[model samples]
Target: MIKVIKPGIQLTIQDLGRVGFRHLGVSRSGSLDTYAHIIANRLVNNHDNDAVLELTVGLCELQFECDTVIALHGADLKATLDGHPLYPGWSYPIKAMQTLKFATGRGGSRAYIAVKGGIECPEVMGSKSTDLGAAIGGFNGRALQSDDIIKITPYAQPWLYNKGALTPPKRKVIRLHQGPHHELLTPECINAFCTTSFTINPNSNRMGVRLDHNNSQIMQHSLSLHSLAVAPGSVQLPPDGNPIVLLNDAQTTGGYPLIGHVIEADLHQFAQFRTADSITFEFVTLEQATAAKSKLDAHLSQLKLSLNRYWAN
Candidate 1:
């Protein structure tokens, strides 16, 4: 069990997210950084879909009430337990009443904390993820607050020491697939979209990330289209032509024109971008995107194998 002493900027429980309910007007609410969330859970021997604490911009403080193993991943927020620095991608033992705190993240936007048996939050729509816009799922369907007590479920497997800390692969350029309307735009506009660097706006959230391309003419362009089903990582261009990347908590449908879609394997890293951070996108063919995803799966399989080897010995 753990008690929330301070509920950072925005901390909530998240899992893989709810699905098969889009027809009911419900959006799939889940961890924005799905890769990090799954890795954190696997580090502690929890299922990949287990519920974990998703900390936005860090700044959370909590007290453990029992001995348990936990892992942190995603953003490097300079976290510490009882003043000692805690490393991500590694499991650590937390003694009873030990307090853990996370400072502001220096690089990424969100961090994930996974316990041994995952968080014991009630499942709504088949997931523990909190959807703030709809006020459903997670801890009472809202963000955690100070004085809230989060219960930790008992683990089925015994606590075991596994591999040492892990280092996430460096993100150089995000790969994007051409959209359905890629041919509609002029060659110069398309080239500008791919070559120019865009800054992440401060108004970014789970719903979507608004990007600033610094081109007034692009924003002046307008388009009209009927609303269509949208998915995570879909980069939509509004009437103003600026891109807004739909994220985990984005609406079920949108009328904006889609400019492109970020590759699935890189969406987690994209979710961790902070405001004003500049990012460049590189276009890739569908076959190339598939290969990239396959490579990512291979890497994760290797990590799992390493953990099993450590436990076997």
Candidate 2:
């Protein structure tokens, strides 16, 4: 068991989220950064789908109740375990009653914590992800609070993982895939969208990461139409001209004119961006997008095989 001392700006338990309930207006409320979540699980020898703790904006404090192995990934939140600095993407043996703390991180906006057997919670709609908008699933369907005790399921399987941490690549240019709605943007606006350095808005949240393009003309070019299917990374230009990238908790459909979709390979990097971060966008061909996704998959597979390899005694 783990006890929450300070729950940070936002603390929630998440898995990969619900599989296919978007037709009913369900939002995918899983970890904002999926790659980091998987890596954290790997460090702890947990399954990819295990429920883990997602800390947004850091400043969290947790106390362990028993000896266990754990891992951390995503944001460099300046975390410390029992007064020793904790590194991301590495596993550590946690002693009973040891306290773990996180400060406001400078690099990214979100962080993930994974334990050996994962967090125990009633799965709702076949998911343990917390949908804060709907208030269903994960620790009574709400964000974790101070004094809440999280139960951890015990796993006794013998496994091996590297003691060293994986270094994540940093990216500034966001890759996008053109959708049919790309035609909605005027040719001038299209160039502006790609050329301009958009700043991440302070109002960004799980629902969407709003971008400040600093140009109002982009918003006037689009007219409202029927609501179309929207998913994570859908770049929508509303009346304000600022483009909002839909994320895990966004609605399944939206009327906002979409300029493009962020490639799957870039979602993890984009999720780590914080307010005021400058990001330039470039649209890529479908072939390029497929190749990028394949690259990420190949990397994950190699990492998994290396970690699960047998070690000769």
Candidate 3:
């Protein structure tokens, strides 16, 4: 069991998210950084879809009721267990009554915490991810609060740990793929979109990220289109002309005009973007996006293979 003494900026339970219900106007609510969440789970030898805690801006404090192995990943939040620093991408064992604390993040916006065998919560609509808009899944379908007792399942497998920690690669440029409506944009507008740098807005969340552009007039001529299916990392331009990148909990459909979609492999990088951080989008071909995704999948597969080998020995 885990006791929440502090809930941080915003902490909630998340997994791969509930899928295939968008036709009914439900959002695909899940972890904003799918890659990091899955990596954290794998580091603890838990199922990739197992429920884990997603902490935004850190500052979460919890106490363990029993000996448990946990893994930390995603953002660098300067987490420590019982006053000892904890590293991302590595699993560490915690004794009973030990306290865990996470300081404010220095480089990222969110962090993932995975315990052995995952957190046991009542699943809703086939997932444990919190859908804040509709108030479903997670701990009563909302961000965690003080005094909440989260049940942790007993670890069935043997206790195992990873020796090394994995950190995300530093990303300065965000890559984008032109959408079907890219041709609808004027040549001048497209040029400005690529040339200018944008800062992430403080109002960003799992639903979408608001980007601050150098000049809003560049999107003055952009027109709204019919509502279409939106996915994570889709850059949409609203009536205000500011670009909002949709995240995991974004609505399935949106009426805003799309500028482009960020490739899947790089979407997790955006999850770490802090307010005021600068980012420039570079357009890439469909082939390039596909190749990048394939490469990432291969790397994940190799990690799984290595994990199996280590456990076998």
Candidate 2 backbone overlaps, count: 0
Q: Judged by lDDT relative to the true structure, which candidate is superior, 1 or 2?
A: 2
Question: What value does the lDDT take at residue 281 in candidate 3?
Answer: 88
CA lDDT of 71 in candidate 3?
89
96-211, model 2: which lDDT tens digit per residue?
79999999878888889999889999999999999999999898999999999999864444435446456457689989988667786788778878888899999989999988
CA deviation > 4 Å runs, candidate 3: 155-160
TM-score for every candidate vs. truth? 0.95, 0.95, 0.95
lDDT of 1 by residue, 75-191 (tens): 889999999999778888777889999998667888899998899978887888899999998888899999999989644345568555454575748889887767766676777
Residue 121 of candidate 2: its Cα lDDT? 93
**Which pairs of residues collide in candidate 3?**
none
Worst 10 residues of 2 by lDDT: 153-162
Candidate that scores best on lDDT: 2
Clashing pairs in 1: none
Task: Determine which window of 10 residues in candidate 1 has minimal summed lDDT.
Answer: 154-163
Runs of candidate 1 exceeding 4 Å displacement = 154-162, 165-167
